[model samples]
Target: MSELTTVARPYARAAFELAVENNNIKAWSEMLSFAAEVVTNPTVEVILSSTKTAQELADLLINICDDKLDKRGQNLINLMAENGRLSVLPRVVELYADLVTEHNQEIDVIVVSAYALAKKQKEELSRSLEKRLARKVNLNCSIDKSLISGMVITAGDLVIDSTASGQLNRLSDTLQS
Candidate 1:
């Protein structure tokens, strides 16, 4: 997966630059997302893995995407096809989305707690995180009954594990030490 990400990064950056230049990041994002879905289809996967020529693969993708892809998007397909990089479309889309998020100065945060958070609680948390992180926060909340109490917050590389289970584990480790 990491190898695919490495291979896809350059293409993603190129696509992002093109989008930025044209002020069409939204369109590019939609096109890339649609193309990724096409490449990941089970039937398409079989054809992609076969001995078809790069041109054939590229044509198949463009035809399937049809009106969803513009001239620029078609050019991207041709370029990636020529490089035998069509299989990396999904990763490319993922990286492109990350670039868009960074450009927007936004962060996606996941919060896992023993129970669902109230609307007011979620709003407060969002404001607090925005102040601390200096970016707009998009919160995704889930419940994990095993957490017992408190919650865990994850944003990019940052993680705050304040759950009762987490605390108990730490205390156990300390006593054993």
Candidate 2:
């Protein structure tokens, strides 16, 4: 993980706890997504990386956020500002997303294939993976033609590289050895 992600862990954990407690995971997800987007804007990104007062930066962000945050959302933003972790907003959001999904008993998987997959294909893939993994699978698909054929599926920290390119590389390595 990156330094920013390491720095953001506590904040994301706290937000996740609060969201789970209130059964407001979806709301918190949206709020964090919004916060991340706001922080990534060129103006706000510079402000966050500068020596400006936290209150000033918070005010500008709040204005840009435009009352999108409820009480919990406000608290998350304040917490980030107070802790000097304003720049970790993006990673914080990602971690929060993982927490929420895991709490909801879902496993997110990234499926990278050589070609574009249809909705039905993705759904079927999810079903197949869910049966094997024994968990509700959320499929995220991507296209990588260099794979030549097949797909690479990643869940949690595991990589199932079923793509021909990955297999060929492994075979080549084996032959070389």
Candidate 3:
């Protein structure tokens, strides 16, 4: 993980917990999405990294955001600005979303195969994976022709690799070893 990830971790966790406790995950997600976008803008990026005073940066942020950020959102941004870690907002938003979904007993899976999967096939795979993992599964799919055949499924820390390309690499490694 990078320094940005490290700095964003605690803020993400705190925001996620607040969202869950208040049963306002959607609202929090929306707020964070806006913050993430604003924080990545060129002007915001300059404000975050420049040697400007903390108050100056915070005012710039508030003025830029105008009506977009709520009190809670501004508070979080202020805290980050005070710490000179505003650049971490994007990472914080991403991790906050991950935490929110995890708290909701949902898992995101990335499926890689040699070809595009049909809608029926995707639905079936998602349902099967949900049953297998005992959680709601959100899926992202991609075609990787280099895989030759079979598919690779990634969910969180777990990965199931059954692609021909993976097998060939494994065979090569074994033979070399």
Query: Among all windows of ten consecutive residues in candidate 1, which has the lowest summed lDDT?
Result: 160-169
Candidate 1 clashing pairs, residues 3+ apart or interchain:
none
| Model 1 lDDT per residue over 1-177, tens place | 899999999999999999999999999999999999999999999999999999999999999999999999999999999999999999999999999999999999999999999999999999999999999999999999988899999999999899998899999999999
Return the top candidate by lDDT: 1
Model 2 lDDT, residue 143, Cα: 93
In terms of lDDT, model 3 sits at: 0.87
Pairs in clash, predicted candidate 2: none
Each prediction's RMSD to truth: 1.1, 2.3, 1.7
Q: Which stretches of model 2 miss by more than 4 angstroms?
A: 116-123
Cα error of candidate 2 at position 16, Å: 1.0
Candidate 3 residue 10 Cα shift, in angstroms, is 0.9
Q: RMSD in Å for candidate 2, one decimal?
A: 2.3
For each candidate, what TM-score against the reference? 0.96, 0.85, 0.91
lDDT of each: 0.96, 0.85, 0.87
- Estimate candidate 1's RMSD in Å: 1.1
Evaluate model 3: give its TM-score.
0.91
Kindly list the per-residue Cα lDDT of model 2 for residues 1-177, writing each as its tens digit.
678778988889999998888988888888889988999999878778888787777777777887778876886787678778778889999988888788778899999999999989888988898998888998888998988899999999889998887898999999999
